[model samples]
Target: MPVQKMDVFDVIVSGAGPAGATTALFLARAGKKVLLLDKEKFPRDKICADNKTWKCLDIVKELGLWKQFQKLPKAEIYGVLVASPNGSEMYTPLHEKDIAERGHWYNVKRIHFDNLLAQAAKKEKNITFKEKCAVVKPIYAVHSKTHISGVTYHDAKGKTHDAWARVVVGADGSQSPIAKAVGHSPVVKGRYATNTRAYFENVKGPMDRCELYYLKGICPGYFWIFPVDKKTCNVGIGMRPEDFERQKKSLEQILRETIALPQFKGRFKKAKQVTAFKEWGLSVLGKRRPCAGNGWVLVGDAGTFAMTFSGEGVGPSMRTGKIAAQGIVRALNENDVSARNLKKHYEDALWKILNPEVKGFRWLEFLLLNERLFDFVIAKSAKNKELIEISSRMQHDYTLSKKLVHPKTALKMLLS
Candidate 1:
């Protein structure tokens, strides 16, 4: 593609992660000239577990990248093993079609998975996917000085340049420049989580199932071991910032101690941690934040779409990217860039799908976080198929989220 005027872009997307790349792919398909910018290079390493919700897969398919995804290395998972703080354990089978379109869930490393999205965006003729270019600040129109005009960025070699667009999409992570420009705060204590991710090899456990252990001090969050293949598994622990601070131990130290507990003695005796543990921050939607403003909109972590209870990210990121693109396509046609315009066209549509979900699951999060109740529920679910089924459906199925907080459901889980 030949260089054009700096102002020739329909949309400028900040960050080439899942949300930005997916948004660019969709907008390009809609015939928009898109500039997808990222500070990192392609095939960059992101510290994360090997879990991809079927919804994430659906977006990959929608972008016509399914065939490419199929060729990547992954583990086919069919069920989950959940253990309580007191060591009570339950195994719940995840049914196909109910949870995923592929009839199985997939677990692939973030390094490979994210790079695939960036590559797909580059394939679009209308998209200029510029890696190693970091957006420095927003350029506001002089007249309004409220809506975005474009952005100034520094390239890989630190050369500064200005790029303009009719609309700007902030698909950047939690600390998005565009989001800040629109008066958004990056982290609020209750709505955020910190996670430490690592990989382990030669683990002794069921290779086809995901394992989650609810630990003391880390209510709602869990230490998870997800299979990446026959020999390797992605392992991690997630906790609210407050919980992590209270523990007063490094994530690496806590992880090691937890593995030494009698309940996990057998599983990790032969296992070797294959990667250094890395800690990162995540913003979850315990409460929704405004996403659209004057000439700009936020998606993915910038919008706080990670599930409140599960700390889920990839699926929601892709989902918002695709949904936002639909609204942006309409906005482009209508030539409206006001905050109110995008509030109706984009934000409303997004929250309609997300509002109830995060609100309902926070109830589930509160209920199961108590150590005694966590133990009781796992013990009962082990013997009662109904309890196990309902527990499995609490996620991926939204109908039960509201009921999960009902007094009847709480009593049923406790007494029945």
Candidate 2:
């Protein structure tokens, strides 16, 4: 997978999503020559819940896209509306302090959201942003196979080209070629989720609250109708591939049947699907993957950063991209791209920031595994404002997410 023709940069980023775009922008701003490549052209359609939490907006502000993002066509989300199998429910609002300070959460379609960042990246003098360039594999230094030197990619013309860099980044998605080159592939069963989504217009739902449903059939796997605006909603469902096997239905079938359920049918009676149902796989393990290595680091899905319980990745991806930039900048300045420095500056530092919360959610994911427990959890949460507040913060910054698995919290859910 080596290439004879070569171009060089200070950093080569493999994907141009939030993670890669953020990394490229930060690196470029730091005066690093960045080669940012993406498999698709700009304004491409990406299947996502398309919601960006307030925490995600913090990074958007940092990237200098806030003012522009504010001008985009989107929804300002206030909270989540969740229902359990028995129809017991809870609505967890974003912390008021944050809502006052940052205007709370948003639902921006990924097409507009990603293009905003990518367009910004393209404008940076230090960044060479290439669209429609698909990476083939990472190029390792001839002397050391462990040290990634750059990448080989297939251009839009199907011609191969090489781009060398002091450090290469695998910001590519879960099925990353670079990830596989580093031996991070072979998707682990039960650590994965199969999901399906589609856009619909004329859906009747609360625009300010994301609607989530946990039903007997879907059980731990869940369904959502996250409104993008007044007239449209992003409808989707997720299931553990292992669990989905027992259902004996396709992801599309599950989504269709879920929508056809009596309760949902009333809401969508006049709503029309604007897009075809699409399926995607996610790396949902809360445990950290090997993200940093000699001359390279992974971010976003490539690093398996999608949340186990919620399947949310945008916030984590941008957060990791921001940190990955810091690591790359430090590495470039010190002229050390070894595994040790990247780990210290990137991996270790990242997990230190995310581990507790992530570990906590991993523990809490158990609640979503069963219909009975989910019903109880939602029921208790609706009755207890304190519970709603804790659940709200848990999605962002509750450090002791694991504690909820024990103590009076568990007891409260059991006995309430």
Candidate 3:
């Protein structure tokens, strides 16, 4: 179908999740004419574990939303409890200070969390938000199929329109249309993980921290129970695609079996399932392809920046959005929207900041995938207070985490 060109924008961000919303928010705050588009309306449900790390909290604070985030109903996460295949558990506090002093992490439903960000972006004078707008394809420049000039999208009423932009930001997530249109493989099959999540109410023994269980059935992946409130928890499981296919059982079946395990059976005996199972894909950071190209850049899941080990993308996604916005601003100022320019200034710099952590997590995922190694680490951490502390700190501090994947530490861990 022919697309009708509409008003031009300084930047058009596709998708309104954390990445897109953050990108639009930053750009609009800088007085850029930004258009934010999303297929769904605000407060729509998003499939995720719904836990925010310290890094994610920092971005929220950076956006000046920390006070408002705190005002919302959320569960304060203090630490993590990890259970090994052998049922041995290790408890690690997230930080030294209490939630009051340090302002601990949180577990919030994405429906509410995303809406908060969308609302923030909506308030920006330079940001024009269009919900129920689905981006169908990238509009390329005349005589150049490789360079994106804008996007063609369909509104709720099925009206097709084209909006031109100097640079288009692809925050559309794992199944990003922009990434597809640009001929970039958004997710490498081997590096991708499949995840399924559901909400449960009246869950017993709900703790103030998140819990992860590495069972025999799922080695490379783990099951998580993240409490969103006193009565509700986000329960989910994640596994490599190969592992998932090998199991032959559906994710729902795996979830059921996981909850029925000896470790979790009692806690879930009285729990009531509040939502149906929903699934999504995650592309770990290390496996991501080039995020920047002519007249466009991809952020968040669209750029495949989720962590390898934990499949956490919120923090990394938001960070990428901020970086992309900065890069877009620079590119706009210089009037250089070429792929080479954006790639050199934005994509390269993004990987520089994120590569080390991605490599570290990739190593961690490799080690944790081994059942014996995972069991040993969990068992050892259970008895070793220092190791537990280190493990806890690694969740928030990438520099500290690098030590875990070091040759010396790996040898020590294996030998000991």
Question: Model 2 over residues 90-199: C-alpha lDDT tens digits?
Answer: 88888877677777788989999999999999999999999999999998899888999989999999998988999999998998899888988637656787889999
The TM-score of predicted model 2 comes to 0.95
- Weakest 10 consecutive residues, lDDT, candidate 1? 95-104
Decide which is better by lDDT, 1 or 3. Answer: 3
TM-score attained by model 3: 0.94
Q: RMSD for all candidates, in order, please.
A: 2.6, 2.4, 2.5
Greater-lDDT candidate between 1 and 2: 2
> Lowest-lDDT window of 10 residues in candidate 3?
94-103
TM-score of each: 0.94, 0.95, 0.94
What is the TM-score ranking, best to worst?
Answer: 2, 3, 1
Q: What lDDT, from 0 to 1, does candidate 2 have?
A: 0.85
Give stretches of model 3 more than 4 Å off.
1-5, 97-102, 405-416
What order do candidates take by lDDT, descending?
2, 3, 1
User: Of the candidates numbered 1 and 2, which has the greater TM-score value?
Assistant: 2
What ranges in model 2 sit over 4 Å off? 1-5, 400-405, 410-416
